[model samples]
Every structure is written in C-alpha cells, then in structure tokens.
Target: MRKKKCTMSIPTIIECFQMGMTSNEIALQANVTARYINSVLQQHNVERQPHSSWLRRYTVNENYFKTWSASMAYVLGFFAADGCLPKDLQLVSFSQKDPKILEDIREELQSTHPIKTNPRTGVHLLNISSKIMKEDLMKLHGMSPKKSTILEFPYVPEEYLSHFVRGFFDGDGNINYKKRTVSFVGGSQTFMEHLKKRLERYSFEPFIVSKEKYHRLFLSGRKTVYHFGQWIYKDKNLYIERKHLEFNREKLPPDQIKDRPFKAHKSAIEARKLKLLYYYNLYRDFPEACKSANIGINTFYRWISTDEEFQLKFNSICNEKKI
Candidate 1:
C-alpha cells in the first residue's frame, strides 16, 4: 500500500507568507511543523518560475510589505505602528520597502499642495540620511515638521544608516555594496531634517540619527558648518553629501549585524551561521571557509532548529550567494 506523499508546495508557503500568515499558522494548516515548512519552501525555487504569474497567483496584500520593516517581520503585528527597522531588519529589502512607510508618513507631509509622490507606488518617502540635523532643517529648508507627533526624530545617524544601507538598500555584486557604503549624495541640513522626520513611521532608529553635526563640532578637523552632513567642494561646486564609511571591524557594531532571530534546522542553520562568520571575516580573514556554524554566536539558531520550515527557507539565502 503506497501512502500519499505530503510534499510541501512552494505556492502554499508563499501563500501563507502572502496572506500575512505566521509560521505557526502555516505549520498548523500544512500539518507540518513550521520549521519543516520553511525548509521545504526554501528548497523549492519559486523564482525559477515566471515572477508575474507567481506574484499574481500569490496575491499578497500591499500593506504586507511593512512586515519587512520589523525584526522578525511581525506576522502577528506585534509592532505594526512601530514598524521601523529592527536590529535584524536585514535579509529583507529595506529601501524598496520604504514606500510602505508612506501611509505612516502622511502626517508629516502637511503641504497644502498635493504631496509629491514616488512614481512606483505613488508614495512620497523621505530620502534616507544620517548627517541631517533637525533644528537646522526648520531654519534652513523652510520645512514645517509636525511638532505633535510621537516620532520626533528627523534624522538617522551614521551607524544606524549603515545598518539600513547594508541590510535593506542592497545592490548587486555578491557583497551588499549599498549597505556597505550606505549613504546619500545630496541635501541641505534642512532637507535631511525633513527626510528624517518622515521616516519615523518606518523602523529607523532616532538616537542613531545625528552624527555628522556632533562629529564636526568635536571630532573632525575641518570647520564643517553644515549640521547634518559634510560640506564638499567638488570642481569648485560647493555642495554636500553624507560621508561614506570604512568596513573596518571597529566600524561595524561590536556584535554581528543585529536583526530578528530567524529560525531554521539545526544542521542547516549551523551550516549557515558558520558560513556567515566565514564570509564576514573571510573578506579580510584570508582564511579558508569554516565548516560548522557558531553555536554560541546568534541565539536565532535555536529557533531555526525548532522550525523546520524557516531552516529550509533560510538555507536558500544562508549560503555564499554573494561569494
């Protein structure tokens, strides 16, 4: 007697993700542990199929994109209103998802005229920046930020900006260049300020909002008058852009890039952790790729072990895709 094979389908997992269903939900309905579901889905290559059909068939809610803003992508809406970039907000597209924050940003765009909007989704999102100063903006750019809103910070500092750039604003070429040198090229102090004020709806951290101004006054040598970013003199054309950063070990946060702890299988997840450490250091380690995942490193490994599905899914991305 041949029993039926309960092979998990890619569309099913994607449907669950699209319907904004959590791992637990998917696990329950699929009659498989969420971890196993993630594992199978990861193995299935939906991308190998036509994207348009895949998306149309999947039909995810537009607002569902906001989940990318949360650490673990609050499937249960634990931090819906507060969906700014979490420590682990990596692994998802951040800049592309910036538009999702527009509904949350509407309060700040108080212009009498029709508020400007981006072409792709018609959502007017602020350009990401770290050097802009809040007070300097109101005085310089003629912007009128809403004083009453709880999301008061109008800027993201250099350190915080790095996280988004590397994690979210990613680019091609294996290594995430956008995140590595995450920075803006133009803007007045005021422009940066207004931009900051609007991004509060997203998960951008406020304390990590202003660094250029503080550095100018105390750390740097030049007399940089601008508050938010640097004052550049290119071809005698005086303008400003946010400064780029180095990839030195000291430059990165003391720990590995923080974000929500993703779950996966013990063996597969461990393999990934080892790979992550290897890649992170291999750039300079000049050593061969290590074999085992770092056990004590990220706590998320346990979650991955328990959830078979996530382990499967993360495996697709956990390896040396960039390398």
Candidate 2:
C-alpha cells in the first residue's frame, strides 16, 4: 500500500526550519520524515543558514554593559529613562516612539532580536531575553523593576557622562521652540537633582521644579539652551533625530527664527499666553484648555490676573462663546 502523506502544516515546518531546527528535529515534532521537512522548506524558498550563522543570530554580547564606552553609557542612560526590567523575567525591554533609536541600540548591544511594533500605539519595542544581561543591568547599574519613582542616577565615568545625559535627554527631555528652553522630566526627584548638579558643574544654572507627577529640570534662555545643546552633542554618536534637528535650528540667525526674540524673554512669555488663550477659545473650558496647553490652572489664572492683554483676549473669547 502507498504511504499516506504527512498532514503537518507547511508553515509550521518552515517556522521550525527558520528557528534553526535540524530537519530531523522538525520531522520528529511534525511526525514526518526528515526528507519531508526539507521538501517543505525548499518549496517555501527557505535556504539553510550555516550553524555558525544560527549561533550568531541568537547570541548577543552579554557583557555589553560591563564597560563604559560612549555607546554603553548612552544606552544605559536611555534605558534608565525608557527601558524596563521585570523582576520575574530574564528579559530587558525598550520602547520608543522612534524606531531608529531602537535599531541603533540593538546594534550597540550586538543583539539580533527583532524590533516589534505595537499596532495599537505604533510604538516600537525591542526585547532581549538573557539572564546575564538582566543581572548585569541590575547589579552593575542599579536598575530595578518599578524604578521610575525611586531610581538613582547611575555612576557614569566622567568621560562618558555627557553621552549618558544626552541619552537620557533623548528619552525624557523636550526642546521648546516657543520658549527657547530645554527641559528634562523625570519621575525621581533625586535623579533630577543629580542631573541638576551635573549641569551646574558645567557652569549651567539648571533648576529643578516639581510637577504634579514628576520633576522637571529646566535650562531656559537661548544662550543657555544653545550651550546645553553644544555640551550634550559635542561628541555624540547616537541621538534622536528630531531633537537634533530642533537644536540645529537654533543655529539660524535671530531674524530667521520665528519662535523667540533674540534678547527679549518677554516675547516668549507673551507667546505662551497667547497659546493658552487660543487653547481656551477652542475648548471653552479652563481646565481642558490648560490640559491641552500643558499648563497648570494656577498658572493660567496668574497669567489672567497679571497680563492685561491676555485677560482682555480671554474675555473676548468668553464673550464670543456666550453670544
């Protein structure tokens, strides 16, 4: 009698082959002959990679965090801001809105793990599952699960400290054009204080302010912000593209830039007041408008009371809405 053909799915066979399983191993799982497994892979245009290539595919430099190179420092800082390590898993994961930084980080870590995207949020994530890597991050770097509120700044060597700060900035910082400010937000008050102290060492007058849920380190004024840009990006190898472009725009002449006046800080405040007023007009609700404008309601009322122009504009908006 003729032998019945194997009923295993072709995709499953191909998956096994792609996962570096030998034909015999796949055959054993699929209950088919080794030749049948090979036939399915061949039919699906799956060429066999050498064993060495397979080894390289799944392996990463587990000791990558042990040294203090610029790349390592930057990655560590970025991880401190955007990465996560679960207490129960041997996994370290990073999520970013920009996938390019994630790709750079993967190369820096010598990891071949796939970068996956969340369909719902369009955020890219890279997960590396290695016990050694996770432990190294915890023991050497003081990173812990649920570290957002209590994380302490890690000990970065003096030479690579700028790179580390730049990495953290790329992850949790903002460059405001209208305000001509560079600000960093962190969940840990102590962490923000540490960062503020470091900035002071460079003669920068960074100050910390408490927000509702976090702390902010602010470096305002065009000259100060520009100097900060220079300091962080002096020897940069990796950075978020959009933020880099934003800082580069500061190089333009004062007349060419429309965001802020060259020497008048009042223009920036006026611009912010006008923006908040505009948001209020659109929403017709003070709290909602404040939320949209990312300002506190107390600040809004202060602006209304202190700035006659802003108060008049707000009154006009409210009157129009009443009509």
lDDT of 2: 0.79
Regions of model 1 farther than 4 Å from truth: 1-100, 109-113, 116-323
Backbone clash count for every predicted candidate, in the order shown: 32, 0
Report the C-alpha displacement of residue 26, candidate 2, in angstroms: 23
**lDDT for each candidate structure:** 0.31, 0.79
TM-score of 1: 0.20
RMSD of 2: 10.5
Model 2: ten consecutive residues of lowest lDDT: 254-263
List the candidate 2 regions with Cα displacement exceeding 4 Å: 1-57, 252-263, 267-323
Relative to the true structure, candidate 2 reaches a TM of 0.65
